[model samples]
Target: MKTAYQQFISREAKLADLPALVALEQACFNSDRLSKRSFKNWLQSTQRIFMVLEQGAEIVGYGLVIMRKGTRLARLYSLAISPTMRGLGLGKQLLIELEKQSVAVGKLFLRLEVEKTNQRAIGLYESMGYKVFGDYKNYYENNNDALRMQKAIRHYSNFSRLPTYPWYQQSTDFTCGPAALMMAMNSIAPKVTMDQKTELDLWREATTIFMMAGHGGCHPLGLALAAEKRGFSAKVFINQALPLFTAGVRSEHKKQTLELVEAQFAAQALQKNIQIETAEFELSVLQNALENGGRVVSLISTYRMDGYKVPHWVTITAMDQDCLYFHDPSVPDGHVMGFDCQHIPLAKEDFIKLSSYGKNKLRTALVLYPNFLNTSLD
Candidate 1:
């Protein structure tokens, strides 16, 4: 019979079955093996249910559950399988059966305890929609902590009705990561209107200093510092990936670049009594920073080859309810550009799609200061 069929039985154990159950329990548990007398008590108790699996009339596995009435909760007491039968999907099947029984008994939730070191068991529970609700420190004989996990059976319709933003816009293939778009929207816009002569002077000065620095594409950091030196709080926003890749290649090269820029601005700000913030992020990073009250400058690139080209930088000047206003460096006349922020709400699905385009090629950065007016350091 063992070779031909397998049987699973959920029934009360008889007095004669104690010796076999005790042997199985000893084989299953290492430190906390159950005694024959304890097995008998559990089997005879009306509040508990003992389930056994048999292959050809030989017991192979067992599980115990403590069913409590009025509270509508079921606690899994123990589950064990023979060493040879491990990873046969039997454990998951037993858990499913127990859940069905609990639901049939009108239980509203199911709970279990697993050791912290037991990653396999923890993963199984988590996959079954069980979430950690509490912990029992040093609960096991080995002093290992136990994680208490629970799964609710009730369906709450109200939870699913909460407001949600759409993932993408249909009219334009131009999409932004939800987090990146949010950061751009949340960032305070640049101020301090410059006359054409002042702007041109600042621009020429920045271009000269940046070109002499031999920093390749990192000229923006120098430009930002030059702007701050002249009594204006300067923010430089660039694509996030450029710095990340640079940092990865040189190991602190990107950090060193920002640190130099910040140090230069800090010295000038101190003399002029101003404050500044310098930061970086990829699309995802920007969203997180924005949600945390960080201000940003946005560098909007020119669309190229079905995507945005690099080297284009912009300073966001102001944000209305849904549109972001910015000064475009690529426009040749330094005109302030306006874009709809609502169309850029960063959603995960949309990010997954857009990020898939260049494989995280888009990047942005931010630099902020308390005051935009002070003195010209450039």
Candidate 2:
């Protein structure tokens, strides 16, 4: 068999490569090895790409990338090289190939987690443009921590500036909207106090009829009205006029109440003459608002940051051509799989993925301009 460093070629992993991949997995890690079954599954999955580094008939390394259908980000599920192939630049070569494959499939960013103690791998990743974004405790089966790393493969623009703002975390799981609103409000109105009581009160005023669990989450209109009550001018953008959170409700009574609350919110928005637009907000609109000393509260699915399938609120503080910077109110889960959430930079397309919720990709956002100026923003 030819050595990987001697004359290596990269190709998609085929069924015949499974045995070699399993052997390489066993040889790479004492624990947390992917099984042959897993390799077969990944090889057959449409959302995943598994590739191998082959030197003639010998397979010496492999990389796996997992992507969601509508997301701009992909996760490097795993990478391994044969022990004898170490220090031969096979890992770097494999990484480069995987990133190319990810971008070819429409992913703008590629992220991964590696054992924190794996200094050699960390050095290789950093040398290859990957940056440590966060970490996870007890991430491996052997109880070893893992460091989260990511790199952008596609560049939308050259802009990379971030806005300065005070970060705030939601005290309760249901208060993400209010907490985000408070952060945006206090950042603009320095004299306003952003306390837990205000967070809860704003939530009380903005919460919808129900949530996927526990108390109902805040509605976009409700949050806009709450901001109006706080002396800020707010413009709303919603894809649908119907009440949200009606999808998962099992009882007709709950659905009816949700409809009523949504109607009330719509009525309040109209009464206040809040400029309501029924379309997906472009990046230019958000950029203009932020430039004019305003911030936006957007509803996103928690799936992108966390594994949960719930609507989440985040405050968009700044953006450049390449990335959108925001203050997420949720506390970071402190895991390799979870994002820091607060004051994080997301790729522009990733922000678009996170901004919409569910199968329909429903859009919701409230752009709160500086003060109480009832100006039409269309």
Candidate 3:
């Protein structure tokens, strides 16, 4: 009997291989095997990483990685090895490749949920640097609990020796934008006060027409205006030319209203001498700005951290060559999604990927420079 394929090759999974994938899933998983339709859907999605380990004509193992559009996390959805090939190192090899693919797609961290009783699998994951963050009761269809594990794949050499900043939880779900803006403003200008009243007031001033499901999120221009109105000099950097939050609003009437509000904010920004640049800001530019007593409020997606299809704001406080430190506004009691939602350190590359919103990865930032009107990070 052929224990494993003599030759090993790894490549992306295609639709044609769906049958084999489904078969392998059935063979490996006693429960929770992905259906053929689900395999087909994942095979065609560019946002996910699906790969199969092949031994000439036979598929021996597979790995699946799912990347959230706006967050710094890449989840290892599944990993499997053939029963006949258990002794081989194919599982480890597949895991290493999955991590590589995850980082290449700009993910800073890797996470997975494993059955609590799967000792061998748990040992493998722990050996590969994953630490158990939490657990869920009755997570599996068979009523087995699952352990949540996470590992930071990227290692940065430089470190920023900066003071710890205050953490603020959003009073309401929709106030992440204002809460983050408040954190950034308070970081740069410590004398500025913040409260729930001010948070809602700022939300009223900076909000667009609609959010993922609520009233609206704060626009970059609107956020800049809000900061400027609070006596902080603000500069806006946006990657997309269109008005922000258009992707979240489906109704044409809402879109038009958002456009009008955006236009109004633009005019006000122009009158106030606030700068708006329609280009991606470089990491060096952000570093320079931070060095010059500037704080950055970035629009990010809550999918990775909160598992919600919504945009969020975060205050980028300090950075060095290796890591970018930020005061995250939406801190959950536990890991609601796959991430820690408080003040956190993210790898630079991952931060770049998470700083934008939507599929196009529209990068936007409100850079508030204190006591430096002439400073420019071009």
Candidate 4:
């Protein structure tokens, strides 16, 4: 069966192929070349995919992709083709196979850097649907600039193209409402500074002064007033006419105090032209607000996050067919990663269940509008 025809194959790099890999690296680029030691180490990393393309037992092309820990992103670290194999369409095969491997490993996006002067490589990447996101100055060993590019690996046609929302962690345990509000505001306008001082100021303006624990949580009306005072428009949605956060307070005096505070907030909202709807809006209505470029601050119980079952605040960032993505302001203990707090996804049914709190199932939401518009839900 032996003939003059040759066959090509693609497989993972092996440690024994170090010599050929180093030789290829040396022959490919004059600068920013991966060292022999780098190739050896990368070939052994469980977090990286180092692949080789072989033609008739000869390694003619290779590529490397690195998977970041605790993220849905993969990076194309390096790719090369033998000078003799150039223009043979083998490099495209290597890249496509690498992308397949990355998607197999649960990566949602792939990112890479190409030298600014490498027009051929840039054209290849762009042809493959990669987009240039940004650039770095003097990024290479030879002082050449690099163009940063990224591609969404998944078929996410139904995924919402969300606005850029800044994330903020609450400095205190009771400031989740303020932190969540700050994120929503900055999503509407980026000039709002994201700092601890601003977070505490928002908390001071919105706190209800009574809770089950040390500090009080922010009332929906107070939060709406806080947004209004800061040059933004908002609409408050309350599920019940009862005063919020009053069920947990054991004393009658504290209940009266929360009522008084709620009244003051309502008065201020009316004076400032903020809309307060004393009824729960449907999930579809919330979707309309976000689709119109509005941001929302929602109250949820932490029973699903931790076992505590305490009230918490999270900002609804984006949504798709199967999941709702939000930013939880409470970066709880043992879950310190920013990944744990930013754009956390939950099933739509589970999120709906998490949106209510307390024995009476108190539900509240604040929808923030970027400007004066038809915010009325028709």
List the global CA lDDT of all models: 0.48, 0.79, 0.77, 0.79
User: Per-residue error at 180 for model 4, in Å?
Assistant: 0.7
Residue 32, model 3: lDDT of 83
Query: Clash number for model 1?
Result: 15
Better of 1 and 4 by lDDT: 4
Q: What tens digits encode model 3's per-residue C-alpha lDDT throughout 102-165?
A: 8887777777889999999999999898878567798889999999787777765334234546
What are the clash counts of all predictions, listed in order? 15, 0, 0, 0
lDDT of candidate 4 over 1-378, digit per residue (tens): 111213768888999989999999888999989888888888888878888888877888789997644345577889999999888777777888888888898776677889999998999999888877566688889989998777767665245343456788788988999999999988777777789998889888998988786788888888888888777788988888857778888888988998898888878888988887877667777777888888889999877555676888889998777557788787565313343456665556667788888888878889998656434221
Task: List candidate 4 stretches off by more than 4 Å.
Answer: 1-157, 160-163, 372-378
List TM-score per model, in order.
0.39, 0.66, 0.57, 0.60
lDDT of 1 by residue, 66-159 (tens): 6542234467777877777778766776677777767776554566788899898888889888877566688788888988776764432111
For candidate 3, the C-alpha RMSD (Å) to the true structure equals 9.0
lDDT of candidate 2 over 1-378, digit per residue (tens) = 112344898888888887888888888889988888888888887877788888778888888987744446688888999999898888998888888888887776777888999999999999987877667799899899998787777866343333447667788878999988988888877666778999989988998858765898998889999888877888988887586678888888888998999899999989988889987668778888887877888888878655778888888877777777677787553222334344455677778777888877888888987654533221
Pick the winner on TM-score between candidates 1 and 3: 3
Predict model 2's lDDT versus the native.
0.79
Segments of candidate 1 deviating more than 4 angstroms: 1-14, 154-378
**Could you tell me the TM-score of candidate 2?**
0.66
Name the lDDT value of residue 150 in candidate 1. Answer: 69
lDDT (C-alpha) at residue 28 in model 4? 90
